[model samples]
Target: MASVQRRLSALLFGVALAGTTLAGTASAHVRYVVDDPADVGSIVSFVASTLAVPAHAAIVGGSALATATGLLAFRRVRPFQRDRDVFADAMADYRDLLPWLLRLAIGIPLVGAGFSGYYFTPLLESDARLLFIGLGFLLLFGLATRLVAAVGLLLYLAGVAVDAVLLLQFEYVGGFLALVLVGSGRPSADDVLERVASDDDSTYARVDPVHALATRFRERVAPAEPYAPVAIRLSLAGAFVYLGLVEKLLNPGYALAVVAKYDLTAIVPVAPELWVVGAALAEIAVGVVLAVGLYTRAAAGLSLVLFTLTLFGLPDDPVLAHLSLFGLASALVITGAGPFSVDELLRTRSASPEDPDA
Candidate 1:
């Protein structure tokens, strides 16, 4: 079941990506001038906007399809009986899971920040963008976290200065810095490196009482192995749920206005009211899946698509608003629902001693 679901997710995502790429490429050929045709600056501006336009548009359609597909998939695999039991067991094993969970919290944002900077042009300079992506990988993998964290800190500070609304980015940088100042903690590649280093011939004297006292102090002050990642995931879930309800259900005028304002009528041929209702339902459905941690990757992947599409309609001040959700969704893509999710429940059931798959 898991394998099949994975394949389905991959197939849907691939189709969306391929379709979007083709559409973007196709649209590029239809020339439209923004200013004097002979002006180099005007030509560049027109070219950039043309290339970007299709992608921004395609993301909405792709996300809507993906979200619908995920909901259908979840209906097929959602564990009806043992979800509560699984959650209980997950909590029981929390101590063992803490390090791994912490890694998700720390690593996902780094990766999200980096990937967004790289893939989304106009966000950063080309060279800096690649560097940002590399930084995410390094941080995600727990390789040279101290150095990566330091770099991330500098980059995020610069980003905040450029666009202060991205306070979340700065917040993440601070978390990374905390890890750098103290340590990457358990299950990190840093710990493995330290372990290997410890085995080398270089010997050190035993710690004195004074040094031990300082170590204790540091431990006391060091950030409580952060759980911000968990909060981010839940917050995303809540935000989307609220948006779905308020924007589409309770007061659809606003949604309709947004759709009309963005000239998104092309994405849906049916009446705007029906499309709005469907979109709202999709958001609510996706939010429920996220909240319950069912098929989280699929849900997050679809959310990523929706968030990407939303960029086109957003005003300048809020243009980057959805970007943070993009990061969270990306992080969830990497981390899934974590230990506290229905996906884990299904996995645990499948692997149970009573099950033949075990």
Candidate 2:
């Protein structure tokens, strides 16, 4: 297990280094062209001219390397190893692909869009807008969960609806908020187990010191369980649902308009439509897989890849989003789907006779 982790870490570090190099280049070129009337256009041109090539190439190379290394690692590690080791290996496998993904998807576009939208629009500076957007999402997320508990089922739907509308207006910030709202609150596995033990006096007294110590060690060293997977899936679902609706209504040609305005056709050589469709499809697929608890580890792996790619493509400013997504993806990759997931349900049902797996 240690060996597998080391190999995975090495691969991920290489990918990250590549992504950072690309991101650095993108950042250097993405200066604010104040002469252009359309701020968005200038930003896009900068991205297309400076950032896109190296970032895209890095992604292609990283993907191949990750795949090859992963195959080699899988062959060496037996499947039915220690449960903790199995979980760790699975997580490492998922995380190894993330750096490249972030470089491609969220990070690159976000830098272009965020700088244009935040700096050129109203009174908000780019950094301030980013903070406000994050804060709004946090507040919305907290409010939505609170509403679900306070107002009951119908109200929960209404709350989600309201939140969705707000998110549509905001885009990435909205998505982030929806994720926070859906996934913000959850006790750690240790907390849950501790609570259970405390409530059951017999269990608490019966837990030997040696057993307790071992369990603590395991908990510290082992990969996370499936809880975060469920949260991320829910968050993705909310974000996509909101984004799909907004894209249809507000700016049906928003992507194209941005592309044409920037003269990206000559610079980037990739159609805006293609990029839009690809990104949308990726997000929708990620949301569906996560929500249904199907191929959760793979879904997480894909998400990590997507985010890592974004990190590379975007400018260096508003570094928080890049860092947050990176950390979140890493966590999901390590933890997988938690105890409440369909994966867990299936495992339980297969092991027992009474319960039907969902």
Candidate 3:
């Protein structure tokens, strides 16, 4: 238990260090040529510059105190009193849903990237857009998924190389990378192949060794049931943290402007600037707690509330944008943080003497 705690502490320290480095970079790029909130890519830079050092210190101090208090209280209780780990129980058959979740997260974005019709222009030109859309459908329908995922991965890699904006958009990059590693989920063509192979073991045994090896290799990268929920939690955590840092903190002026436009100040009975600062602090804290997988249910539930509130203020153009994030937050609330989080570690160590493996 002590060793595990040390390892967890080390991992968390590394993540915090990385975040600090990124924040510094964000701060350096505060001023930009384009201040349009619609651009989205520059939001983090705006946040770092908007919040002064004292403001940052106050928020950090408050979050630390809260986290410490919560940890102490959590230590005193026997929360995981169930026979099994709650996360494992909730995700008993998660593998069955992994493909669908991956498809929605990765494929939907590809579709959006290529969508250029009545209301909006495509992110890519005609030929590229068509190819992108084709890849998206292939992924979504579970048709030739490996080939499509490979192509999509390469395409995103190329885009990142050419356009730095994609690097800043963690959601898209994270989704694409996850698909590349996991391939399509169950009920896809991959499953069909597996079923066919299993149906005739003798025939499969006679197949070329190289082909079998390739198949085995692909399976190695497939998403496992135990980890999918945690992966989703991490992805949402990164996206939210980035948004909180870049979108709200870095761009307080724009945030305040939007709040005023939507009469958010009137609804909350707080000054717009104070509201922006408070919201940013909450967002950042939620992101950090979620990222570390600590009190994940509470953090995600709070995030869901925040996301729901935003829906009331969002214009039509951005309303759809928040829906997926809201869904992710809601899913976390239902699923908890899974095995990859600090909550699980704490629960495991704090198990009673009678339940040695708890």
Candidate 4:
């Protein structure tokens, strides 16, 4: 389901319009930049045509078969368990960085959106540039992080209500909610203030106004902190699914336009239909695997690869727009699946003495 997430730069008029035009060229979304791109005929027809090609069908089938075989082999052999456990331990030790990682993921995009003259997404121009920039800086600094994240989330929700396009980056909602639950990690203003406030005789504690509210907020929300990964995973998976299923498969014209405009088939030397359908299917598969928490870290790795490939594959794709996805994927590689995940279930089941084979 990884089909979507557009750029934040679009033009209006005058000098600013010119700036928008220039900025938009850096955007990766062909639909936004192209005038009227070719549709990939009908989705069904295009898919059938691709599959009808014996070579294409064999390629797709072989890939799926290989993937299935690999998964089964990994389960049965469980090779490199010691090294894997070491890597897992290493990842666990860095859990404190999770809050900062989330902030970087969501905050950088908000700032990019502000500077690009669009709202939360490229679907609409924004008037609140300074506001978004300000909030982004605050989140980046880890200053009043929870409050800023809350504000960011509220503003995003409001925008979504009006246009529904903001849903394209719905992961921001999860990121914000997770921030509110997790608070700022070490070395942040919030963390320092909390420490100072906890000290009854600290001189700085008397002037720290946010410390009490932060403490109270933490006490109330701390219980839900474990679900942060759940929110992020589901939100990201939904975004990917929408992008793959709706933006690419249903509205194939924009993608086909991009393919033709860029002559992408020349790069890979494949039918454009195969390229589009292949990408859509890859995205959907990644999203489903991620949603189910199967090899969570591995899924994140694939996400990183896909995002990077899109950036390089489409020379004009906006680098800024993909920053959030990149950040989120990196964070997931660190955090893995939280509660309410198959990863958790498997871990619990594997711990049972009666299930020694597991």
Candidate 5:
């Protein structure tokens, strides 16, 4: 058991800290490290010009047609329908992993921020690295999970109060809240201790620490578990929208700087100004889709694709800072839109009127 704990600790540290710290050029915490351009065209002008480009207009129309056709095919075809059901069922089977994933989503970024010399946002310098690191490792260990998450949230809120730049990493709010709602998951020390405490036959049962208190704490918050997905989705959506609108659209100069720095226009064969505008529009659209829970899995899958493309295309972007977004997206793919979502309402309406079970 001691050796197993050691291995887990080692693995967590290696992935959360060592791997990220070793990457020299990676520094994207909302592109904070990117230098601003001396001057740039207005976002409105860029958008207007892109709309005037015949090739760009054709590509947009073609994409919309393809998406609509694909959706229709999935609905009409037996194999496609069967595959969708099978994939959803597979995802549902692993619902127990949600908490652990949320923990990692919140924890890894905290550890990364601490090690990377930031205070939740790369824009804000950090002086409490050990505090963040300690809270992070505790969450990863799944010990005092709820308490740790709550503390993390409080610290983040305090940081936001100090510097609004923390808002750029606002997705952390959803992750921490979700962890508070769901608590620790399987393969965690908390789960192991709880099991031990429940089993009278086990030698360590009587001395199991924290399990009883943790149980009472979790039970108190059990009623809100259904909203976990809501919190995560909304938070992620907000971050995407904020990044697109406030960061890119309103601050086109810096965004255009990013485009030119990475030479994104060369890869896409579009004007550099159009690249900034197009990205802003795409991100806003993604956020809106996620917020509504319309084709949620598809949106999340696209989010993963977007994150991957960004990581590969812009080599300087911090892989660690974006790890939380990846975890959240993966969680959504697993959980979908839980309650209070358009998907839930649609599902209910689609159920058979005479025999809903069927």
Candidate 6:
């Protein structure tokens, strides 16, 4: 039953991916915006003149037929349930084919549609950065599974969010989600079960903490390990602080004017200079807290609020700088410094009173 369900699920997912790709391709080509604007008379004329509808129809029809064939293949494999063992064996057989079908359905259309869209859409040329970003995301999804590439996915999604806000082009978010789903859906339940069944008993032997600690201390930390969430958070915080300072330095008069315009005195109902001082101090304090991973969540939250306000209040400038700061703020809020954090150290100490560090 599980095997049948898995096969059915694979077929459905493949069909869905194909349908989405076809729709995206059709939308890309059969639009008024694709044609030469100077020669265009009316919207309808532009669309009709540019779109190769017959070609699109032929491609989509072929894809639909292929999807139907995949479904039929799945149905043909459904009746081999002689026993539990036979069912398991049949599922194993299906798994081999199903992943390949999914790869085909998802990959071929994305590449084809991406190329068609890139060539046909004038907007993509105007905003080449976004096009490159989208292509990078698709390539990343193809190269690595989402679980192993979670950090990369997170970064890409962050970039997408910032781009969406700046350009008001929200479709990229949907594309990002689709890529994530495709990359993350690879390892099924049967794969996990097989891995567990194949585990060696000796590998589960108890560890000596003293020896473990000695080994850890003696060995140099691996470079890849620094790419973990906590390290990323600290690095991101430092970058944000540096960028913000650079912005302040470049436009010192403007920065001071912004501080004055907000009327910190009236808002705080206290000494005006003190209020300005407090805000400045708070910015520095939050950066320090984030750097040391102390009160990380609170620090990140504060930083987010500060950056959001800056994004709205600052003078209209290049979109990239604003978006980059916003992305960093969002990342800090979402990740909140992982294991290599002062907050974690405190939590560990509190949880275990017997520890020497505690």
Please report the candidate that would top TM-score against the real structure: 4
Evaluated against the true structure, the overall lDDT of model 1 is: 0.48
Write candidate 3's Cα lDDT for 175-281 as tens digits: 44445545666767666655565555658646634446547667655434344455556666666666567656776666665666567777867556556667767
In model 3, which range of ten residues has the least summed lDDT? 24-33
For each candidate in turn, give its C-alpha RMSD to the true structure in angstroms: 14.5, 15.4, 7.2, 9.0, 9.4, 25.2
What TM value does model 3 have?
0.68
Ranking by TM-score: 4, 5, 3, 1, 2, 6
Count: clashes, candidate 3: 8
Error of 2 at 110 (Å): 18
Give each model a TM-score: 0.43, 0.39, 0.68, 0.85, 0.82, 0.36
Superposed Cα deviation of residue 196, candidate 1 (Å): 17
Q: Give Cα-based local distance difference scores for all models.
A: 0.48, 0.39, 0.55, 0.70, 0.71, 0.37
Give the count of colliding residue pairs in each prediction.
0, 29, 8, 13, 1, 0
Which lDDT tens digits does candidate 6 get at residues 1-358? 4554355345434423322222211101111121221222343442333233565334435655775676467434533334533433543454333222333323333243344443112233223344444543444344333222344335434644444221222222222332233332334432343344445453422332233442342242222222233433443444434333322222233333444555534545633323323343344445455656765544556666765655454334323323323443344444345555675676575632211110
Candidate 3 error regions (>4 Å): 1-75, 78-88, 117-127, 197-214, 222-231, 319-340, 352-358
lDDT of 1 at 337: 64
**What C-alpha root-mean-square deviation, in Å, does candidate 1 show against the real structure?**
14.5
Q: Is candidate 1 or candidate 5 better by lDDT?
A: 5
Ordered by lDDT, highest first, the candidates read 5, 4, 3, 1, 2, 6
Angstrom error at residue 46, model 2: 27
Alpha-carbon error at 248 in model 3, in Å? 2.3
Question: Looking at candidate 2, what is the lDDT of residue 239?
Answer: 41
Better candidate number, 3 or 6, judged by lDDT: 3
Worst 10 residues of 2 by lDDT: 22-31
